[model samples]
Target: MENNFKMVAKTLFGFEELLAKELKQLGAQAVTIGVRHVSFVGDKGFMYKANLGLRTAIKILKPIAKFKVINENDLYNKVNAIPWENYLKSDGSLAVGATLNGDTFTHSQYVSLKTKDAIVDRFRDQTGERPNVDLRFPDLKIDIHIDRHFCTVSLDSSGESLHKRGYKIATNIAPINEVLAAGLIMLSGWDGQSDFMDPMCGSGTVLIEAAMIACNIPPNLMRNEFGFERWGDWDVDLFEKIEESLLSKTRDFHHKIMGFDKSPSAVEKATQNVENAKLEDFIYIKHEDFFKTQKGGEEHLHMVFNPPYGERLDIEMETFYSSIGSTLKHKYPGTNAWMISSNLEALKHVGLRPSRKIKLFNAKLEARFSKYEMYAGTKKTHKLEAKND
Candidate 1:
């Protein structure tokens, strides 16, 4: 359609496919996956839907201009040539953020500052006033991406990252990012068909994300605002219609969603966050040491959690990981367990061999997301049974 424009949805490493899948499911066009990003075509309403419904995307950007620059001076000149008045009022507030992929632009901060200067200069020259830089609450947020000499300037449609789902008012130490949590759950192939659990649930992020995914609820439905909401062409009616459409598609989840934490304060915080997300009925948060508990019922279980590694890999972490393996191996039978941890040496202490291992990152630290399958009986017995079948 003529109204459709290109947009780039940024995501974490190893999540490009997940984001692309989400965009397609949300009705985006020409979906293409890139490293840590996905590009697609969509109308303004689809843009709003992408921001609200995408579970793995960090932010979405609508490119306004793309050019090749010889130097910073050329960048400034080209940026200044674009008409800023079309997007932002001369007296409005704005913010600029930049990313660089080549050695030509060694510092991202310098690029961001130059872009801001160019836009401000354009407004100042044409209207006798310029928008002030407001990093926190900007009326317009611009994103600059420089790959070698190529530059693409875009409007950030999602103001803050989409992970700020507005439901986590309280947090425990090392609470997982909501986008990453949701991606991990999808990667594990859980489709709301069976019981879900986070044994070491911190702040209940995983539990909340799992509940949302299970019910097909939009991840950002509770978000306070998106960058497009502050755009000059913001459409409240269209956005509301999109929201209603997403809500209409949400399905009821029959399986239980559960979380457990050893820390009382962590349990309290997770409970509060669950209540904040209005998922108390679907999600049950408990104060229990995971290692001491046994799996209940004969139904299958899907478990995903990120265990704490403290400051570094130490004796305690090794013991903690060993206990995790032992607990799953003995008590938590008939379960498919997944864990992400950056401590490679400590992970070796887990006696059970992982059925699958995928490289991922937790913040800046390189991590591995691994899966373990515990059978109802011994592995040998299960294998024999499978052979008979």
Candidate 2:
């Protein structure tokens, strides 16, 4: 137990509970949810596993020190007091990034500069050399958080945001974030038991994420690097063992996973990305207007998509939303459709009451994720008319 240390996995808004559940399911101990993060205790190997396995996590941070500071000078002193030599060599490169949530720190950039100066000064004074700042690639990536007078310094274990997943080589206009896509799929409660689809697949992010979840695949297996790989005490054998352990748990996915887009360019890009992820066998992308399509099978279908919202004129968007409602209501029976949109007014034109609506964010814009359940037989028409009324 002594070997276990507290780590925080940062996530997007409205995803704290989902990320917490993911960590707990991954065998984390003492899991607790924070505003946009989940803190837990895990050993170094678990850290590697979390980075590879957690579909909802943005980045994992290991807290190195926490202290109280009233002024900038106090911040410099406390940061300088940390044993940076143990984490980085004098010749190594480093980067410091900060987030401030209180009055004491007015500018996050200024805070990052102060922290970087302290570390560089310490190394220069003790070893006659200092690590240079490298934002793109660093030997050690440090994170600083200042809440009022409380300060926490942490080491970033995942080099890039986990959303990069390294599977996407091409992107279309306004492609969905991979982390958000995975979280949305999880929230929708799709488990590979039924056929899955993303009608407006764009670059096929959702379809890929759904297949990964269904197959129990590690999300970051395709990633080229992690922050821990460059740490001073990096252990190659331990990391490889953790990776193999996660890979061994991957299971077979039998159901169909498909995507559709009106644009031929989008279909091409999506196909390329699916091949890059080596999931082409499990995923199929087709160029077709989703509005013109019907359910291909009699079995229940689970759908999640991000439709165009407000990009066109108001009248056009309203018609588009209404067509979506009409298509699902009349054509796609025995299906459950979920969509996320920032256009609340356009969503109203859909003409069917959402059985469930959850507030979320698409980047900086406040959005809504809603669900529509279409049943089989005559009940479908009756329920659709009732919701419309």
Candidate 3:
């Protein structure tokens, strides 16, 4: 209990509740939800579990200090006063990233530089040696967030965003981020109980995340490394035990998970990624236009995908979305179809009313995750529900 500390798991917008629930499920103490983040208390083992198991988190930060600062010098002095040796060795490398939400610190880069200088200076003064700044692969990654007059200094426990799940092969096809992909599936409320499909799957990120969720597999199990691995107090045995514990909880997924892409290159890439994730046994990929594809079985198919929003592709979005609605209404009966799009105007052209509209952000663009339910029963009932909606 004495070793426990407060940590914050950062997530995308509209996923606070999801992350909070995840934290609570993971046996975190004092789980509290904030805007785009959740704070909880846990020991080092729990921190490792979070970075490995959290599907919706982008990063996990363990705050070490919080103070009120009026200016840059005060910030530097407070940071310099901390015992840097306790976290990083004098000969180790470091990296600092900053985010500012208020007028007190308008420049994040300058603040990061200042904070880095303070830490190096502290080490130099104490031990006559200083840690080098290695931004690419730092031994210690620090995060500084200044919100209005309040400032937080935290040690980043998930190096390089947790979205880089390490299983994705580099490709030109821009897929949805892994963290966002997992969150979208969670928000859609799919538990891997029924058949799952990603109609417009680009790089198969949704399919992979869905399969992992269905089997209760840790999203970051395949990650190359985490920030805590390089920490001074890193315990290899403890981490392996946590990994084994998580693996033991994984359940078998009996339902089918599949994806379709019009582009052959996308199909190949998705297939390769699924293989890289070692989930080929669970996911099926095919090169077929989503518009022409039909739901295969009547096993309550659950669909989640991110369609092109006309930002990159030159296709007619209105017609594309109309085909989506048409396919769901005609061919994909008894399916709960959900898609995210930044183009609100194009979404209006889908022709079917969405049962639910969740406000979310895709990167910097504000988007909506819309749900359309196609009933298996009488057309009259489906139309009545649509009319009521």
Candidate 4:
């Protein structure tokens, strides 16, 4: 238990609970949810597992020190006191990023620069050598979080954001973030129990994530690298053991996972991504206009997608959203459809009242994730109309 240390998994807004649930399911101890992040206690091997397995996490951080700082000099002193050699080599490259919440630090960039200077100064003073700064690919990635007078310095365990799962070499114009796609699927309550789909799937993110979730596949198994891989204490055998343990728990998913994109190019890219992920057997991608498609059978379908909300005009977007609503209403019965869009005005054109709506963000844009449940039969459709009437 002495080896167990606290770690934080950062996620998107509205995904804190999902990330916490993922950490708990992955055998984390003392899991607790915070704003856009989850704190958990785990050992080194468990930390590796958390980085590799969590679907909703954007990055995982291992806090090394937390102290109160009243000024920039105090910040430098606190950061410099930590043993930098323990995490990085004299010849290694490092990067520092900071997030400031209090008025004490008005500029996060300045804070990052100060932290970097402290680490480099320490190394230079002790060994006459210092790690160079490499923001793109660093041997050590440090994160500083300051809330009011409290400052927390942590080492980033996952690099390049967990959303870059390395399987998507090709993408559509507006491919959804892999983390957001997975979170949306989780929020939809789809556990690979029935047929799943992304009706407007672009580049197959949702499809691949669905397949991975259904089969218990570790999300970052295909990632090119993790920040810990470059650490001074990096252990290859321990990491391999954790990976094997995760692979051993993968369950078989029987239900079909399908994707539809109107654009042939998008479908091709999606298919390529699915193949890249080695999930082609579990996923099927088609270049068909979703508006024209109907439910293939009597089986219930679970759909999650993000429709286009780009530079199109209001009337066109309204028509598109209305078509989406109409397609689900008449053609796709016995289905639970979920969608996310930043265009609130266009969303009102959908006509059908959403059963549930949750506030979320699609990158920088504020968006709403809404669900529409269609009843099973023609009678239910008439009943729905009657209720609306």
Candidate 5:
């Protein structure tokens, strides 16, 4: 218990709660939620597990110190005074990133530069050799977050963002981010007990993430590297054991997972991504427009998709969105259809009041994840009645 330390898992906007839940389920203690962030207590082995397992998190930061600073010099001195040697060798490479949210610190780049100079200078003064700055492959990645007058110095434990799950080698126009896609699926509350789908499954990100969730596969199992791999106290054997334990929990998913896209190129790219993730047997992709498709069989269905938002003028945004509603209501029954779009006004054209509307950020654009329930036959016809009324 003494070895357990506080760590912050950063996530996309509106995914903090999902990340917190994931951490708690993964055995994280003292779980606390913040804006786009979750704080928890875990030991070294647990840290590796979190990195390997957490799907909603963007990065994991291990805080080393926290203090209030009035100016940039105070920040530099505070950062330099820390024992960098413990984390980075004199000959190793390093990178520093800073985020500013106060009037005093106007430029984030300048703050990062100052912090870098201090650390390199300390190494030069002591060992006559300073660590080189290697932004691409740093021995230690440092994070400086300044909120108001408060500054927190931390070590970035998840390098290159957790979204780079190492399975996506192909992408199409508007292919959704892996982390955002996973969070959306989790938020939609689709357990593996039912048939799952992503109608417009460009690059198969959502479909792959869905299969992983259904079978309890760690999101980052295909990732080439995790930030903790470079830590001074990395334990390879423990990480292997953790990996084995996580993989051991995998279960069979009996429901069908399907995908469709109007573009044949998109279908090809998505199929390639599916194969890359080694989930080809679990997912099926076809080149078909979502609006022209229909649900079959007596199975209940759960769907999550990102149709073209017309952000770059592919089609009439309103008409396209309306088509989404018409397709779901008339074709897909006994199903819960969820879609996300930054075009809120166009979403109004869907004409079906959402059962759940959640605010989420797709990259920098603010979007809404809204759900429309399609009942079997005239059953639960209230949605259509409400639409007509």
Candidate 6:
């Protein structure tokens, strides 16, 4: 049998390219990008590596079965045929989830329930034993994706969402998701070459992720567990070797990675999170309002942050965004400033023209990530051309 198998990595919108690049760097083969996902071929070790290293992937799934279906019965029959015994024991537990674009399946929960029934019934009919359902920690997590009359059943090789990088225990009011934070940092093209800052550094997610990227630290090293750890063929020795090899490649990051938040509580939380990630030596956090701040030095500063999005309108968003624009233009010359916001109307108030803008999603709200280039000249008129007369 072929050790190489197909796997799909689900990602947020606009992160497909970043996820593909991450998979490619980690040695995945035949990588192809799909809408909100990327498929590739890799062995079990590669799967584990992807789980550990892919910064942009939300989850990794291994497709085991696919079939055409007319209705719920068809879905049930298709799910029942998969060899569940090979993946889990009769005493093992399972969780089932689904996505849909089919007429027969109106509710994802019902589809998930049907899929679970099929898996449990198969085991009961064969060995007279049924597995228990444990949604938190399942022996086999199954995914059902229905598009039209076609349904695909897959094993969730990633138990928890990959965003749970296991580094963050403390959080502020608006801590960014690990995957999204990493993706945003990578997209900013800050390759650990210069000083970095996250002004509204609630929980210091961006700072910690940036340090990890700068030092080449494996994101999942602190993870409590990986789904593949429960697999029968898990080779601890091989995994340890892989971990060691990756660790050996990690280089030291010398530049300062700093964070600033307005709230003292936020500063405390960010500092604690930084310590939890074992990165206190490389990162520094402080309590300060971003708008009132200026650059620490004359060096080029690379900043990536998610400022308050008027969640409660405590701060006048128009003034807040304008202050962000004013701070960059007046206080932060020689800096490349980037921010993401779900409040599109408020974003326009930041008058400095953006050099780049990308569409993204912050949870359920649509968001935009925009970049502003603040050149190192007083009353800077942006990057301009000399008049030739």
TM-score of each: 0.98, 0.96, 0.97, 0.95, 0.96, 0.96
**Which clashing pairs does model 2 show?**
159-227
Question: Model 4: residues >4 Å from true position, as ranges?
Answer: 311-315, 378-389
lDDT of 6 at 189: 93
TM-score for predicted model 2 compared with the true structure: 0.96
Tell me the lDDT of model 5 at 187: 93
Model 1, range 1-389, lDDT digits (tens) per residue?
Answer: 89999999999999998888888888999999889999999999999999999999999999999999989999999999998889999999999999999888989999999999999999988889989999999999999999999999999999999989999999976889999999999999999999999999989999999999999999999988999999989999999999999999999999999999989999999999999999998999889999899999999999999998765423488788999999999999999999999889889999999999999988998999999999998899999999999
Model 1: number of clashes? 1
lDDT of 2 by residue, 81-107 (tens): 999998999999999899998887889
Score candidate 6 by TM-score against the native. 0.96
Error in Å for residue 231 of model 1:
0.8
Candidate 4: residue 347 lDDT (0-100): 94
| lDDT score of residue 155 within candidate 2 | 98
What clash pairs does model 6 have? Answer: none
Rate residue 181 of model 3 by lDDT: 93
Q: After superposition, how far is residue 229 of candidate 5 from its true place, in Å?
A: 1.4
Q: What are the RMSD figures for all models against the true structure?
A: 1.2, 2.9, 2.3, 2.9, 2.9, 2.1
lDDT (Cα, tens digit) per residue for candidate 3, span 147-175: 99888999999999999999899453457
Please give the distance, in angstroms, between residue 241's alpha carbon in candidate 5 and its true position after superposition: 0.9
**In candidate 5, where is summed lDDT lowest over 10 consecutive residues?**
377-386
- Model 4 alpha-carbon miss at residue 11, Å: 0.6
Q: Output candidate 1 Cα RMSD.
A: 1.2
Model 2 has how many clashing residue pairs?
A: 1
Q: Write the per-residue lDDT of candidate 5 for residues 287-347, one digit (tens) a residue.
A: 9988888998878899999877777548888888888888888898889998999988899
Q: How would you encode candidate 6's per-residue C-alpha lDDT over 15-68 as one tens digit per residue?
A: 999999999999999999999899999998888888888889988999998889
Which pairs of residues collide in model 5? none
